[model samples]
Target: MKQDANEFSSFAETIASLGSLTKLESAMSAAIKSSRVPAKETRKMLKCMSIQEAGNTALFQFMRDLFEKVGVGQLVLIRNDIFRYDFAIDNSPVCKLYPHVKGKKTCYITAESLSQFFTKDLGLPGTAEEIACQNAGDNRCEFAVSLQPLAVYQLALDQLDKTIIGSVIDGAGPDKISESLEMSRDEIIFRMNILKRYKILDDDYQITEIGETYHKYGEGMGGDEEEFQPPWKDMAVISNAISASTSFAEAFTEAASQEPLWDVEEKDIVNLAEQAKKSKSFAELLSKQVKSDMEE
Candidate 1:
């Protein structure tokens, strides 16, 4: 009886020790389900990576936009990998909530939020870990995400985006890559900038050791990528609705002229109706700035 009692006592103590962590896990899950942070936002971030060619600064801005939309503030990208990402938040709110709590990682909610956001919302098979926390005397709260290889490839790369790598494999220069891929010289430059940002290609536009491995294994592996529904379906629905109504397109085109293309104002949603019209011609409008999200 004493032995059984001791075992039960140990189990109870274990649960108690993990009580806050479990509660945090539950809160993160509930927030994710309720917020339903659109997958399109994530897709937009990846798309921005390809098109903006503005490097980490642009990436950080997109993340800021995304996390702010979902009520997670001040997210900054630290280290980005093809199948992994590292992020940090400054002066974390959850940590601030626990002034007396110190000496250990206390930002379980933010860490779990990132994990659930990637796994549940983005459909990326991954988990995020809190590597550093201000409560633990770190300057910022850092979270690292490790995603499965093929799943990330499916989500991150467009079919044509791989052409640059293919060109590199064949000893093709930027000009050759551009000609083979039917992309403009400017577009090729943008793509090269993105490749360099990944360290996949070096200064001479040659594929690095990592790029060679990425080519050997990561390429042509996501056969089931099409099974996943794109987040742009909602926009497609609106497009279909407009296409269904014959008058909508003409009316939209007239208003779209007044609408800004890539530089749409964020604070003003008053002209969202006009923006929807622009979304119909999203490719043409973003043509100068971006090509497309993912061209199948």
Candidate 2:
């Protein structure tokens, strides 16, 4: 919503502090609902502001700052073109949403539009069908084509890891990085250039000393190296452990709290045991223990 710039900045800072995409989305959605701006418009503006760095660069940067705050990932621009959509999946590509043109024109597709198209026309499973249905209202025929946040998040994370890590380890060009990440070469180059600008790497596609250090010590940098690290490294490890523990707790709760499946007969278990007799380590005693635990 259009709060005073100072007020907006303060609120943005608060949202940034929360550091998780899920939390940020929740906070932003709440703010949008409370603000003078239409909720749908506010959401659309937020999505577009996330991927672009033009007039609304400050706002988008703030959004990206939220990503960094939560320690997930940073938003890096991959491309810009008229009448076309250009972006990277994770940090892999500067994929053009439309064909390129020589002369500049006002023709452009916002990130919202591209997300909608992918969730709708492309038959990408797990797209945000609920959001799409909510946005479309009575025109909900496209609801079947929606994607889930988890699916998108996984795809984005995979692409980012492949691009950034692949480039660092293999000295692969951006094109190779894109291919490895399942993104277009253009997107890889665009995101790589951004990483370069951020001083994460150099123009020669070499990992800078700073980048290497971050790779070794940064949050989520897993390995035995973590044991011999500094206090900040311990802090990162604790944060990661908390995140993992919370996620595991949620998953365990979900599973344990679910309605129990239909019961199986003793005969069924005996028959299954007989069938699994040839299975490796399928001892009758072990199976009995397992069934007993399940029953309890």
Identify the candidate with maximal lDDT. 1
What are the per-residue Cα lDDT tens digits for candidate 2 across 1-296? 12211221222221222122223233323222222222222222223322344325443344344333333234444432211223222321111111121122111112333344344322223322112221222221121223443333222222364348546756776766677679887777666665564455787867877566555545242222112222222334434443543453344335534534346454444443333322222134346658867997
Which residue runs of candidate 1 sit more than 4 Å off their true CA positions?
1-27, 34-74, 78-84, 148-150, 208-213, 224-296
Residue 128 in candidate 1 has what lDDT?
81
Summing lDDT over every window of 10 consecutive residues in candidate 1, give the lowest-scoring window: 4-13
lDDT of 1 by residue, 8-89 (tens): 1232222232332333334334444433334434544554452223234432454355454434457877766666778888
Q: In model 2, where do residues sit more than 4 Å from their true spots?
A: 1-54, 57-163, 219-296
Clashing pairs in 1: none
Q: Indicate which candidate wins on TM-score.
A: 1
Provide the lDDT at 143 for model 1: 94
